[model samples]
Target: MTSQPPGAHLPDHPEFLWRNPEPKKAYDVVIIGGGGHGLATAHYLAKNHGITNVAVLEKGWLAGGNMARNTTIIRSNYLWDESAGIYEHSLKLWEGLEEDLGYPILFSQRGVLNLAHTLQDVRDSVRRVEANKLNGIDAQWVGPDEVKKLCPVVNTSSDIRYPVLGATYQPRAGIAKHDYVAWGFARRADEAGIDIIQNCAVTGFIRKDNKVVGVRTTRGDIAAGQVALCAAGHTSTLTDMLGFRTPLQSHPLQALVSELLEPVHPTVVMSNHVHVYVSQAHKGELVMGAGIDSYNGYGQRGAFHIIERQMAAAVELFPAFARAHLLRTWAGIVDVCPDASPIVGRTPYDNVYLDCGWGTGGFKATPGLGWCFADTIANDEPHPYIAPFSLDRFVTGALVDEHGAAAVAH
Candidate 1:
């Protein structure tokens, strides 16, 4: 493949390029995706292991996929052991992202409250809080009085659809700037000599004797010693091109941002019984999200009814939000596995690594997933943190089930 002329604009760089640099024909590792996880992987591979011969391929602009489209809520209150441990590590990384990257990720430790409206919901919240606490995360069950004191705008009184009994509160759970996180990682990775290739689509894989040797992209063919697939929603499609079938199904998940208003919503609030979660952005815009689309589709479009249902639920939880008009709505495709957990290890192929099936919790897992995935790629063995999410679990029924907690937007 012919390399681009010297002093060309890098794919992940958003601004104009004063000077273009020549592209290398090969790399030690090629990561497919410029999203948060992909960029983070490149950063760790270079900074942690001194692996600078790396390239990240992106079909569009950097972080144009789920990484930039998420609501940016970060937390570690999962009910399952495997998920809780991994997410806790990710949260710890987020706490120091600004200092580590030298770019402000704007991580706000505003805390998160998982509201329990029914008896069963309360029981589940209590159980998850205990699980998270045992995993060294700050999660606790709070009574109605405590919930009201934390979020006075919420309607926690009785006579509601799902009366608020209590909630699980995580003081460390909060929000971050999604775009900033992606850009911070991208800039740092680029500075470390990792090529960030944008507008590059991986059409096929080059394999010899059942081992992936390189990737064929829209730009051109690039040889690599190892290839890691970090494409989130397009993971199944990419795998199919490589002659493998994944159990992932892509679905559209929608979220909205309301017009700027006074700071009323303090903490992130999620309700399982209502299937809604709401948090206020740093700009005073109330960002809200609901469950995934019922059917499977590659399209990122959602019907208006989805947002309407979510708005109604939000208003029901916080009556004061009744007048907050929504400014815009957006959608993103999520690759959901059968068990709603991720698949993050070697595939059937020898050298091809898999890092997909994030479902709805991928954004918060950027750091931890990258840390584990880099280890898997470097050591040629799945890390203990991600061993439970292997592809073999599907057939062996060793699923790391987090459907209960994730259903309510954990």
Candidate 2:
């Protein structure tokens, strides 16, 4: 299959050879979860390390999980250095991802502005912007007037509750087409001779001397030299197959899109205090969402009050969006960690690794996550870029606190 190289686009009718490869009897690696991260992990294994004897097991179709449901926002601004490092690495990959994967990911680097609504919010954002710059990440602070100039539709008046005080702007941050990312990674992995088995769910683990050697799936028991569980919201269930436990709590994260209108909202605007985010897609539909459900639940749907308040905040911020017809609303399960960071390292079992606990921020970290995960799985050690987010951090009292920076934008 031939694909137009990046920046060399034709009619976009690239041939595809990726298909349902039956589960193999044994493989060097088996990545569970066929979403963006899983497929990416598989692709990197073959493309980078020449580990082509790999299989990706998915319960559903590729990108059918949170991979497709997310708002597709990408950025690297974080308060902590560790969080900033990996995310910045991810953002760097996102920069050339479409070309590297031979797919047009529709990456628009317009910018991402995190809106501040109160004095404390402004201070917090100011500190974050400074820290981001110090870490060699591009970031800036924009006052209310500059925020309006960036996104003229934003309401900057202090008359309303949680008024727009200012914002932290990342000029390099923006959105990418999520579906292209999924399909692109899948095709690339397939081209590298990696098998992608869909509609197959992992039921249990094959262990020896407390080491996970393989997994028992709906298809059959497939043995592997190593297993990487990239399951997003269902990390706990997958880990349960080994009789182990993690601190992952599943919560509902809801998002909605308005009917297509003329381009009005320019860059992505995320308001943490107001608990809403708005970004105009390439198709002109405004994608909006807010914080996760307050309680833990596995259902892919959340309480209406969460979306209701989100819409209310949207209208308060952009009154013009009030008249915009709501076309569709959906929710995805987000695996929340206690410190609102991600888990991306080895598990208790020697041969098993995990890339879960991303909460709402998994989509943006796809490339970097897979790159590091593939390295970790291949060498049986953690990559320096992803080492800080290891499972031991939870017990080591060295958590990367990104709750305030991530809760609104993911």
Candidate 3:
């Protein structure tokens, strides 16, 4: 097969020789998602660890799932040490994405300001600021005056239901071009000989005795030495096919983008009190997001109530948003764990791995999770960074709770 260099246009790449009705073929590793995490995992496995025989199975176009649907917020401010450490490392990786991937991810270090409304909110922000600082993340407590200086458009003194008191500022926290990250990894992984099989759905797992051997996809079964399920919202379904239960609930998270305005919003503004966050894209559009659905649903559709509530919150944060016309709205399924942390590492089955339950914070963690997952798959052992988020933690009651501050936004 004539292969093209990484990042070359599709027409320049070799035509896919392996088509359906072609039965089972063996692979060293198989990842069950073509989003940023799975693609990044494939890229790292080949680029970093010299593991070339990998396959990424995608049901649709690459990054057509949550990776494409995210609002693209990246931050490393968390209350717990483990969470802080992992995300901070992820942030660092994001900073150098352009150099590593040889494609500009367009990382904007525009800063993230998480607003505190109540006196209790202010206290919680202070504690979180201190915690993030202790973890060596650039987080600081900013009062109303400082908050105004950072985001002059915000109405800090408004007599709303939840009045603003203070905020936690992280200058290093920012956003990146979400699609570019996914495409960059996909292109590089493809160049590294990782078979990216698109329009393929995994039907079941091929098990030998107590161990998983490979995956049975809609296209056909592929014999894989090891299988890693990175299927985000559909994580539980895939695990169930393998005869294992996952402690996860899938919910729909909605986000909206406004018509291109004249670049007013400079910083990412998050409000725990109002339960909303907004940031402007490079194209001058304002990307706004809010909490998930009250009830769980497999449908990716969102409710009108969420849009109304988000607009109300946005207007409260920045009164000018009331005049800003909402251009489009979209929703993606978020796989949430009971503790709001991801489950990563080897499963009870030998040769089976998992990377799921990321909820809303998964976008920022793509690089970190992918790097650790690649190491785990290549070395046949879970990396220390992912040990705390293992599936066994649920049964053992070892939950890394980030409920106070990181709850809403993440």
Candidate 4:
């Protein structure tokens, strides 16, 4: 047997990554949501900004929300510069994240293939590949034969419903163990003295004039010098208290996995036309995800038809999957913006920072968003990478609009 690469091994019984601290009476910074984004932000706040007086309040267990529910695909082959900037930055950080956090995240560079099924898809995909290359991201367009060579399980037959004309391949794009990624950040942040308070839901905001001074949580009212909203789907619930509405809609993004199987799939494959994304986990489960549900809801469970439809597409793409037994299905509530991009800047309240509307890109953008958001909260200025994602962009009509590049439908 060969030795595993650094940060690629997981112990059978992992140690606790963080403590179950009680909510403090007040903190210099109060971050809502203890998922990947919230935990990463706290990690950066302590590591980068020297802001250890921070509290990450979560309604549920850490990383148990969308962090555990996501498909864990990481890539930066986007159409727009803003999208590419943040995502590529995140991908670069992911390359060194395990060493930085001093924990195992099991990050793999197995690459990703975004298939193009139609003539228009081919044109758009090739254009995005050029855009990615121009932005210094590793990307290229591969024909059907190349796709087959990369992932032999893929059915590149022209007679299929959505024939694979070609695909944009990102050689560095892959996946990490979502739970371990969050735990690594959480452990580092906790070691730096940042409080990870779980089961403390932020019920409302405490404001002094135009500034948010604290939050009312189930634990109690806690004072804060600054409030950062890193809550994913439940962001609007807190934002509504600020009296301004974000042009966002919440939907349940569904994913499923198959029983343990032999390693047949070696890379991530996503098809916008077929509305499915497939990747094999390091532990042998065939992880798969489909487009978000059409209805506006926050349930962790989605309609069975959505699962049935995605499996149909999966079988067509990988015929061997037709006999795979489904392990389980789950959903994550994602807040989608009208322009298909995120909003990550100042809100109506002076001391409150907004980081929502990530839709399907949350897990991939965790570290990059956390790094930039910590800077935004520390220096009280928008990070250049996230400047284009400010809430004002919606009103100013300067939307990033990544519908075509967001991969999974929103």
Q: Which ranges in model 4 have alpha carbons more than 4 Å from their true place?
A: 1-16
lDDT of 3: 0.86
Q: Whole-model lDDT, candidate 2?
A: 0.88
Which candidate, 1 or 2, has the higher lDDT?
2
Q: By how many angstroms RMSD does model 3 differ from the true structure?
A: 3.4
Residue pairs in clash, model 3: none
Lowest lDDT sum, 10 consecutive residues, model 1, at 1-10
Q: What lDDT does each candidate get?
A: 0.86, 0.88, 0.86, 0.89
Off by over 4 Å in 3: 1-24
Predicted candidate 4 versus true structure: per-residue lDDT over 1-410, tens digit per residue: 11222544544333444677888899999999999999999999988989999999989877788998999999888889999999999999999998999888888999999999999998888898898889999999999999999999999999978999989899999999888888888889999999999888878877799898889999999999999999889888887877899888999999999999999999999988888899999889999999988999888989999999999999999998999999999999999998899999899888999999999899999999999999999999999999999999877899898887646632
If scored against the real structure, what TM-score would every candidate get?
Answer: 0.95, 0.96, 0.94, 0.96
Q: If ranked by TM-score, best first, what sequence of candidates would result? A: 4, 2, 1, 3
Of the pair 1 and 4, which is ahead by lDDT? 4
| Residue lDDT tens for model 1, 1-410 | 12222233345444532112334689999999989999999988887788889889888877889997889989988888899878988998888888888777778999999988878887787888888878888988899899999989889878888888999999999999887788778878888878888888998988899888888988888998999999999999889989989999999999999999999889999887888998999889999999898889888777788888999999999899898787999999999888889999988888889999988899999988888888889889988988889998988999987777744664
lDDT winner among the candidates? Answer: 4
Model 1: pairs clashing at backbone N, Cα or C within 3 Å: 6-20, 7-19, 7-20, 7-21, 8-20, 8-21, 11-198
